[model samples]
Target: MERAFVVLGAIFGVAGTAAAAAASHITGAGSGLDTAANFLLFHAPALIGIALLVKTGTVHANIGRFGGLLVLVGVALFSGQLALRALADASLFPMAAPAGGTTLMIGWLLVGLAALVGPRRV
Candidate 1:
């Protein structure tokens, strides 16, 4: 699980960087690519940190794993749709971005809950 998160984090980080560069060079003002890049960049490190925390026994593994999965799904939906719209004028679905945003929020909330409710040491 920890290894999976780490791999995902690295992938996200690289993809985010590439998206950011593309946004700067290929996208104009008001392009959703920038938003996608921002979301990807922001969450990459968080996912990596969650993996480390889980491996170190600082967080509940199951909860952290679920949260990480949420983050991954959120990123794929939100960023994926935005990139598609920006680059190709397409939509993943009717409300994919909104759904992704909601999922991202839920994922973050779960992470916070994990921190608050996870087992603690003396």
Candidate 2:
């Protein structure tokens, strides 16, 4: 689980940087890839931190795992849909991006809650 989070973070970070570059150079303004890249970039470090916190007992394992799952799914859906639309002119679904965004918000809240309520080492 920890490895998964780190790998996901790396993947997202790489893809986000590439997408940002493409958006700037190839797509220009209004391509919408900028938003997707921003989400990926922002969440990359967060996902990694979640893994570390959980591993270190700063967050409950179960809650952290679940939150991380949601975060992964949320990123995939949100960024996937937007990138698909912008680059391939396709849609994952009608409301997939919005749903993903909401999921991300909920997952983040859960992660915070886990930290506050969990039993942590002194």
TM-scores of all models? 0.91, 0.93
> What's the residue-level lDDT of 54 in candidate 1?
76
Residue-by-residue lDDT tens digits, candidate 2, 1-122: 98899999999999999989989998876888988999899999988999998889888888888888899889989998888889999999999999998998888888888887895545
lDDT of each: 0.84, 0.89
Model 1 segments beyond 4 Å from truth? Answer: 120-122
Q: Give all candidate RMSDs, comma-separated.
A: 2.0, 1.8
Model 2, residue 11: displacement in angstroms? 0.2
Off by over 4 Å in 2: 120-122
For candidate 1, write residues 7-78 as lDDT tens digits.
888888888898889998999646989889888888888889988877887776677778878888888899
Candidate 1 global TM-score: 0.91
Q: For candidate 1, what is the lDDT?
A: 0.84
